[model samples]
Target: MKSDERMRLMDLLHVLKKRYATKAYDATRRIPEETVNQLLEALRYSPSSVNAQPWHFIVADDEAGRQRVAKATPDIGSLAYNRPKVLQASHVVVLCARNELPESYLTEVLDKEQQDGRYVDSTARDGFAAARAGYVKQHLDAGDVMFWNQKQVYIAQGFLLLAAGLLGVDATPIEGFLPEALSEEFGLEEKGLTPLVMVSLGYHADSDANARLPKSRLARDVVFSKA
Candidate 1:
């Protein structure tokens, strides 16, 4: 590899190593709007199976909205641990997945693809739609449509986390909250959306204890395999 290319790759590794699951945040500081917009774009462009894109992001940057999400982590339950992180972060993004992909939803996706010049002719569009229909049908038959959608949402979460890290922002990907309560609070069920995960974003507090801890991970030999 070229010297410059190696340096660029190393920079990305540096960013990944620097990022941690921030447990505490400086509430008084907020990420710039420009950076937040880029983070949203990162989520928007995340890849999904069959281009389903069956996910929605609810950005809670306001006091009321943040408080509503924080409520899902009640103080006396399994979810209590995440309450402080949610409340202290400058923004909390509620990652939601569609509960069902009705025929209309699939058609909408294909229609947009065609409009975006993804197809050269009607036959091409029809072929793509037919292929996607088969994939969706297989999952539906197995009663895994919701599970499939949830998996896609995690892809987007990864994009958000890496984007935030590259932009020098701290983030915590949280799954220890009450999904049902969050869905109800945000009227997600009415829209056929289910809350799957939440990410708290902000600058880490100067006094954050976690900032001083070393990162721990399994050895590369145990994690990676060459087939």
Candidate 2:
């Protein structure tokens, strides 16, 4: 690789190395409006299986909005530990997965794909649609369609965390909340969405011990294999 390309590769890895799941957030700090918008745009561009885009994110930035989100986090058990992060973080995003994929949503995505020139012509669009539909059917027949969709959502979350880290933002990916409570609080079921995970974004507080800790991971030998 060129020297510039090698430098960029190192820089990106450095960001991942330095970033940690924030344990505490400085409530006084806020991500600017422009940066927040950019983050959401990056999230939308996250790829999925057959481009299903089977996720919706609800963002809470203001106190009232965060408070509403906090109501869904139970005060008992380990979930209570995440409640403060939900409320004190500059923003919290509840990542939702579609409960079911209906024909209407598929049509909607296909329409946008066509409108954006994703296919060269009608024949290509039709071929692409058939290929996507076959994959959807395979998941449906296996009774794991939701799981399949949530896998795509998780991929998007990975993208979001990396993008946030590159922007010098702290984040905490939370999975301890009660999904039922969140769904009810947000009336997500009415919109055909099910809560899957949440992520808090902000600057880290001095009290965040995790931010000061070193990152530990398996050795490259254990994590990779040559084909």
Error of 1 at 126 (Å): 0.8
Model 1 per-residue lDDT at 159: 95
lDDT of 2 by residue, 83-202 (tens): 999989999998999977888999999999999989899999999889999999999999998899889899989998999999999999999888888888889999998888899999
Q: In model 1, state the lDDT of residue 63.
A: 85
**Clashing pairs in model 1, backbone N/Cα/C closer than 3 A:** none
How do all models score by TM-score? 0.96, 0.96
96-131 per-residue lDDT for model 1 (tens digits): 999999999999999999999999999999999999
Model 2: CA > 4 A from native: none
Give the 10-residue window scoring lowest on summed lDDT in candidate 2: 70-79
Backbone Cα, N, C clashes tallied per candidate: 0, 0
